[model samples]
Target chain A: MSKQKAVLSEEQIKTRRGRSVALAVTLGVLVAMFYVITIVKLGPGIMDRPL
Target chain B: MTMLEQTQGLHEDATDLGGRGSVSDYIALLKPRVMSLVVFTAAVGLVMAPGNQHPILSFISILCIAIGGGASGALNMWWDADIDAVMSRTKKRPIPAGKITRQEAFAFGMVLSFGSVLTLGLVANWVAAGLLAFTIFFYVVIYTMWLKRSTPQNIVIGGAAGALPPMVGWAAVTGDVTLVSIALFMITFTWTPPHFWALALVKNGDYQAAGVPMLPVVAGETATRHQIVLYSLLLLPVGMAPYFLGFASVFYGVGSAVLGLVFLGYAIRVWRVREGDAAKKTAMSLFKFSLFYLMLIFAGLLAENMIGLV
Candidate 1:
């Protein structure tokens, strides 16, 4: 049987997989940053004891 | 003209009427139904959050999220024009129909994306801003480009993009990701497969012709039916998370459970029907009810918050 040829470079393969997860992580961080700042500002007011 | 030429002439004439790339058609490219769901969920998240926002800012925040969601939808449609042209279900979309050029769609999407992100960051908070930016990027780059053509698992993973709106709305209010907001995200994420698979069951031929590796095409009808049932089952408990978290009330709990059961029953019917016109009807019914189910769950939460019962 003929041997199978590998067509894509390892770098190319890595980039292909890296792009999706990287994008997800990058967005996750952006969302997380917004989350922290908003919490810091609104936390006190929301948790305040109502008169 | 020869017979072939006459047929070709008729085909061209048919395409002319079918290919209306008008201004109204371009707006329809934004997937308004999906955008409406994003807007509604984001609204519920904002209203449910504990802090009191100035009504104007709240409106601005929700509007920004809606615009950001629309921007993602536009970019998705723009990039997927080639694939859209191949799929009968999507062939009438603006870019695919030649109503809007790819470049024009790209520009519109980028402008809206940037404007929405910056505006939300300025008016609402950095958290909302960041979520907006990531959401745009996720849908455009990850879901539209990377996932759609590459895998049968596209909708499952890319469901995260659609689930971000409520989290963005929550961030707008609380400026932090909390258990409650994440739970809201999870509910949508879990519900997505069941909702989409129902539609996919009805549109299997379109997906097959388009060469998209949708679950129904890649996995076949039997697996698609089974997975729909499984996800609908999982969705039942997740739909009630807001009530358990004290972000909603008993009304929401009861409403969500009843809706979840109804959804599950439809999924079960779709699974049992299997094939033929009956199966198609079952899938179509599930598809319609799933939309109402999602809307009702969010509406129940909004009503609970309005009454100060959360």
Candidate 2:
């Protein structure tokens, strides 16, 4: 027995690509936002954290 | 395969997958207009709070509040898709237009809701996050699901959810609610009825057809108009409460009084005109003016606060 695979049309593929890029951009922004927020929360004493 | 055959195959695959919405359609789920007002009021509240917040944290707090408000809006569209399909104003919304499914909207709303609340907690404080969570819950469950269809006083009570943003902003700064924040809350709270009832007057038929018990639909236009005037009158003092409470300056007080008077005048026009196109035009005018009234009131407070800071 052969397994059936889902196939996407050209338009669907394009849309999928668009969604992926948007998600990636959003995640990147979130990462940057968290980093900045973390630094802001830590203040000038951030380097004083014990390793 | 020939070009035509390949195209046909692609079409078949696309059909099988269903209609995929564009990014804009997803953004539409957030109700950006309402989010803007939320952002404005929340920012005002943050600025008006006694303590100083770092500009970056303040920006992040506003961002999170806006996202939380948008998340509630998405959840509202998800729940109200049925009625949204029937109403002229809402029929073109992403869900009703079949651009997005309910499940997708629900997931989007939930993700943003949790993300915003958690992020706000991590950055600001738990009190603000807790308020945001409550706001989302109140808007989604208490207002949209329960009160909206069941009562004409839906927006009256549910208006609390909208009124909470400023309080949330205040909490983010002070870590506790205070009388000044409550004064800010009261302004928006008192303003909501007249603002919404005015729109309800014009959209009576839409609400009727959609079976949503808007004030005009449930209690008739006369009562709604009367309520609008009454609320508008009540709003004058409430709107000026910040100034009276010593939080805002005389500029805000005078501005709020003038705007409140104009808002009342519109409401009176809405009350007097009760037939045909003239009625709708008056109602629409009031509705439009209501937006500016609220925006200007908040802007005045925000401006005063900024001046005080300087």
Candidate 3:
């Protein structure tokens, strides 16, 4: 959540963008890891299903 | 945030006023440095186990163990924020520095604890998950809250939590612990006193002010140094246990012996040199070398396993 603040300077805006990018990248990597593990663990049974 | 702003924020937090923090602050609550060590030791246990484990399950199990370790750190920070604020070494922690609120830190830790434990149980076996749960409980409740300030032997007993990762990792793969894993646990368990007492000797003033009963604070520095030397002596054999047990090769055996000797030498320096500046320097030297000693021993085990595979 954004804190209440005055108008940002150019440097402040750049720093904010950097922080957001880092957070997004980290979360994305974690999500992708879980996704790969989920597919690898469960996909084979579903692929060979008869029902 | 600026220092002035952070100070104001901490003051507000102390008075039950409101403040805000960022994702990095939340992450810092997990103590990533300690988490890395836990993850490494746990991964070593899993990989070296002579049992089959699916790659996906092993990854998940290790990840869950790391998260559990991180959760313990967060819970520890939450409970010890008071002492942390007073201690120079820990005053800049996320909570005390006003980067995170106490309630938020505690909530974050609780969520991670339950999530990691339950997910590990579902993905791996209940045995591994149960060990993770116990490790967290031991670190948070048994070590951080109960024993930390109550007794001088706090780190001695609290070391169990730090030492559990390997057992958890081994159990994840084999679904049962073996003597090898127990030996790994013991190495870390005994290694704790010297590793921590070295730092305790340096930070006696902080422990004194925080009212934490560190061995140096309660037993005096000379006594603490004697204990460090004793523990270092014990560590020499324990460090070589993997090779002696035939799990690791002779390369590890030789490396561990040299490293253990160096470790003992540092502790001996701390014990023998009892002057003013010289004593502090030796204590700090032992403190720094202890980190390297632990890292190298574990790395030696990993390398031996890899060489065997080759």
Question: Best-fitting candidate, measured by TM-score?
Answer: 2
A1-51: candidate 3 lDDT, tens digit per residue: 989856666755665676688769967976887777677667778577677
Please give the TM-score that candidate 1 achieves against the real structure.
0.80
Ranking according to TM-score, highest score first:
2, 3, 1
Candidate 3 residue pairs in backbone clash: none
Alpha-carbon error at B81 in model 3, in Å? 0.6
DockQ of each: 0.02, 0.52, 0.22
Runs with alpha carbons beyond 4 Å of true place in candidate 3 = A1-34, A48-51, B1-19
Docking class of 2: medium
Show the lowest summed lDDT stretch of 10 residues, model 2 chain B. Answer: B3-12
How do the residues B194-290 of candidate 3 rate in per-residue lDDT, one tens digit apiece?
9899888888888887778899889898889889999999999999998898888777888899999999999899999987888888889998998
Which residue pairs clash within candidate 1? Answer: A34-B127, A35-B175, A35-B176, A38-B175, A39-B175, B21-B99
Write the residue-wise lDDT of candidate 2 on B1-310 in tens digits. Answer: 5322332222223343444767788889999999999999999899888887889999999999999999999999988887787788988998778777777888899999999999999989999999999999999999999999999999999999999999999999989999999999998999899888888888888898777899888888888888998999999899989889887778777888888899889888988999999999999999899898889988888887777732
Q: Pick the candidate with the highest DockQ.
A: 2
Query: Which residue runs of candidate 1 sit more than 4 Å off their true CA positions?
Result: A1-51, B1-22
Q: Each candidate's lDDT (Cα)?
A: 0.81, 0.88, 0.85
Cα shift from native, residue B83, model 3 (Å):
0.4
TM-score computed on alpha carbons, candidate 3: 0.87
C-alpha lDDT (0 to 100) for residue A35 of candidate 2: 91
Task: Report residue A33 deviation for candidate 2 (angstroms).
Answer: 1.1
Q: Quick one: RMSD of model 3?
A: 4.5
